[model samples]
Each structure stands twice: as C-alpha cells, then as structure tokens.
Target: MSALLAEDLLNQMIPPLKSTDTTAKAARWLEEFHVGQLPVVTGTHYQGLITENDLADYENPDTQLAELPLRYADTYVQHDQHFFRIMELAIQNRIQLVPVLDEQQEYAGVVTVSDALAAFGPVPGPAGQGSILVLTMEERDYSLSQISRYVEENNAKILSAHVVADEHDPFRIRLTLRLNTDNLARITATLERFGYLVSAQFSGTAAVSEDEQDRFDALLRYLSV
Candidate 1:
C-alpha cells in the first residue's frame, strides 16, 4: 500500500504568515480560521509556529512575529515524511498543527490534526467492513508474525493493527487488530488457545454505538484544541 505522506495532507488553503506580520494579524487569522495555531514564515522559509496563548501576554498587538517568542522553530517534518510522523510530532508537542518543509528547508504548508485524522479514516472501526479485536499482553510476548499466524490458521486476515503501551503498566501493551471478517469467534478462540488475551471484540456487521461515536468526537475535539 502507498504511504500517506505529509504532502498528501498539506492544507495549502491555510495561509502562512511572514515574520514581519504583526501579532494582531496572526491573532486575527487564528480567530478567522477558528484555529488555535498558525505557522510563521520568512519568504519561503519557515520560522516557527505561533499560538494564541503565546501572544496572550503581549499587550501590544502590533508586535512583530520576529520579536515574539516563536515555538517549535525546528519542529517540522519533510514533505515526503509519512503522516504518522506528522501525528507523532503533533501529539508529542501537544500542538494542533504541524509544519511541513520542502527539500530546500522552505515552508511547504501545515497539517491540522483534524485533517490528518480525517485522511486517516476509521481504520480499526466500523467505518470499514471488518471486526476489531483488542488484546493485552506483556510487551516482550507481543509478536505480529505469531499473531498473524494464529489468525491465518482460522482463515482470517488482519486488515490493520495498532499497538499502544499500557499507561499504568509500562511493561504491558494493548494490541488492537482489525480483521477482514465480521465473525471473530474462530479467530478469537485461536488467539486465546495460544495464550493471547482477547480483551474486547467489535463486530463489523454491528452498528457503531452512540456512546462510541460520542467518545470519538470528544477525542477529536480535544486534539483539535
């Protein structure tokens, strides 16, 4: 499958500001666009990202962006970088927007967390015709090949897989897998037979519950802010 790169999700419509632009101008753009952050550039070169909070302490709206404390000046990914990289940077920095740069280190555009997730779609969800199986195990015992083999034995294929570290237990991990079939009884049984703990199962044939939809919306709102 082709990788979803940064350039593919770039929001060219979201304009960048010049360093000479006043804080007032940046703030206006933020309000107008309903975004918390905006990228500041010098000619084609990216300076850094500026947030509304960054300008809150500044009494003078006319202060030049060059004089203000711009953040994440070096926090940018290449245009060709995978979208996952963009997501990592956004989450790690707790920022809503990530800047993309060209090979010459010039500003390309910015990617909003909302846009990134929208492009990512519902991978391990009911949006696609597949079943979701969540498994929890010791980090050391996790192996994709082994898991795949168990599923394949039941004549099932994994459509997508995601791994997340357990927050309370660092040595444990949670694995969420999307299978190509709605019926997960056989695959679940096979995995448990091999000592893999299946924590939750969602059938593709079932409609996504209202509660789950609410949670998704809440998560997206939190990330966007």
Candidate 2:
C-alpha cells in the first residue's frame, strides 16, 4: 500500500466518550486503555478531548463530560488524510490519540499515536541496518537527483527509496528513504534546511534495555494475532 491513510490505521477498540458519560466512567476508560486522554463527541459531532487531569479536580464522580471544559475541540483529521497528518495532530496537541472526521466533518473514529507511528515508520524492503526517514513534499518540488546528491554530501547512501502519491492531494507525494546510517541528525538537518519535511522517522540503532526488548517482543507477538 503506497498511500496509507489515517482511516486505515484507526483503532476502533477505543470508543469515544459521549456527553452523558460521567467523569468516573471516563477515568476508568483511561486507565483501562492505558491512554492519557479520549475523544468526547456528541453523536457524529466531535466536541473535544477529555484527559485524566481534567477529571482529577472534579469532586463529583458523576459529573458529565459535557459539563467539564475540554481541550483541542477542533483537533482532528479527515478520513482521506494521510497517516502523517495523524502524527502531526497528535504531536501538536500532545495527546495520546487523534480524533478523525468524515467528509462532512463529522466524527468517524479515533487514531492512536502508537498506531500512527507504527504504520508510518516502516517501508517494505530487504532487511537492512539503517534508519528510515519519511518526507512529504509537493510532487513538483521532488528531484531525486538533487536529493540523492544531498544525502551523498553527508557521506551516506540511500539504500532504498519508496515514493507514494498523497491520496488527499494529487499534487503531493510521500517519500520514504532507507539510509545506510542510523545517525540521521545531519541528513535530517540538511534536508530541513533545504525545505524538506521530515515527518515520521524510524531510528534503528538505539540501545534497547532488557525490559524494553522483552516488551517489544511481547508487542510483536500480540500484533501477530
């Protein structure tokens, strides 16, 4: 799938909070799902996001979500938006999940940050040992020769490159680059200086502790289902 959209990565298992939902139920859902926040909606119309901190002060566990102040009411993406848009919303709002909207700007579902990063990180290729970087730019602005020259200037080589047309914008494209080095600090900086958007990235050379490795292995096993 060249173009992976936000709708494709939606985690439907996480339900939205309605106006009548109480603070108690919201707290329980947050803890149950291990998420810091959840989207609050009134039918198809998305209201905002409710977080754990928003519920801590309310003395009444029965207080309705509609009664509390919500943040990031307008933070959401459309069904046709790319997964990169989901990551942008999540990072800009610092929320665990991003709410999704439909063609009419009505609530469709929610996309978790983890799911978005997971789907956006990897590119299909033979197993290699470098980092993966994703770039989004206008199709007219793309010049593989110029980009390849830039990477070469940094003393690195591009192992593989994958280009995908943006689903929402025909004039735009997404480029996934598998570099021969895990140290992307310089290449990314150089690309940014030249006006390239380094969106989602996967750095493969970080040291992983025993516990972290075990957790990752467990997650892989779970995803295999």
Candidate 3:
C-alpha cells in the first residue's frame, strides 16, 4: 500500500567492498555480480564508489581501493528519498547503481537502475482505467481545478493527469488525463465546445482499431526521432 523508497530497492546481492580490498577483487566482484560499480565502505561510513572504468587505469591488479581516486563519492540518496530521486541521480551521474544512506548518513546499501525502473513501470495503475484523453492548450490556460470541474460536470472523474510541453511549441502544453469512463463522447464534446482541443483519445485496453494502431505506430516513430 505504500510507495517504494530508496532503501526498498537496496541490493544486498552486490555487497560493499572495503578500501583495503584489491582492484583485482573489486573487478572480480563487479563481473561476478554483473554490475558496473561497487560501493567502498569503511564500516558504516561510505568511502565512495569504485567503477569498472576507474579500475582500468590501475597498472597493478593488487592495488588497494584506498589508493585509487574514486568518483561519484557524493552521488547517493538518503534512505527516505523517493524512488524517482534514485533514477534522477543515476541518470545525472551516468551510473548504473545508486548508493543509499541512512539517517546517520551511513551507507545503507545500493539500488540498481533496473530495480527502480521495474518498480516504477506499473505506476498510476488500475486506478486510471477506462479512457485516456489528451488536450493541447497554451501553458497559461492550463488549470487542474477547471478541468476537473469539466469532467465532473459530465458525471465522470479524472483518475490521473499529467502535463508535458508540446514538442513543436514550447508555449503550448499537452495535458494527458486518464478518466474513469470509457464512453468519452460527451466529455470530449463538452471540452471542444468550451475551446479546448481534444488532441487524442484511447480506450482503457491496448487493443485499438487498425487505423488507430497505424497512427500510434507513427507517433512512436516521431517521438523516438
């Protein structure tokens, strides 16, 4: 029932290595655990992260981590931080795994990018079933309360809504909403009559008409470009 936290994704399978550990051992563990990096710790105090690329510079395989110049030492999330923050930091730092710290600022564990993504993939779940509607309007005209009022006026409730800037026009925004009703004819009509552009519509399920599928495929290609 609770949202996932940074500590929830902590992967103990990839254990932390000590500063006195050899580069040979770190490299071996990275390969064994199928990870790009490993945490170097001095008991509860996190020393920093030692990555595969970082070890490549070492001429000797027996070199200790304490003698190595570590990167992403400060790149870590607090245990209580949101799961989204973990992904943000991972992408920002270009690392495959993120470190988590406890209340005492001690190394709690690490969260893999894959684990965080898997946990996020099914979000806004079944609550946002039925129909999905998209509207394109100027950023200044966007109002959640006004839109909710319109949906409620049609005897429907918006399950979830998200806003993104129009790719072609930064001044305009694309609002996507998941409603509780599949029959969106009345809602769409009322919105269009009130000067709102109903850009797209989709049923709750993945099944779509051939024509719609073609358009959806084209849209995916365009976004990828």
TM-score of each prediction = 0.61, 0.68, 0.57
The C-alpha stretches of model 3 lying farther than 4 A from their native spots are 122-225
lDDT ranking of the models:
2, 1, 3
* Local accuracy of candidate 3 as per-residue lDDT tens digits, 39-71: 999888998899888988997998999999888
Tell me, by lDDT, which candidate is best. Answer: 2
Tell me the TM-score of model 2. Answer: 0.68
lDDT of 2 by residue, 31-94 (tens): 9999999999898899999998899989899999999989889898888776656655665566
Ranking, TM-score, top scorer first: 2, 1, 3
Candidate 2: misplaced stretches above 4 Å?
122-154, 157-169, 176-225
Candidate 3 global lDDT: 0.76
> What TM-score would candidate 3 get against the native?
0.57
Worst 10 residues of 3 by lDDT: 216-225
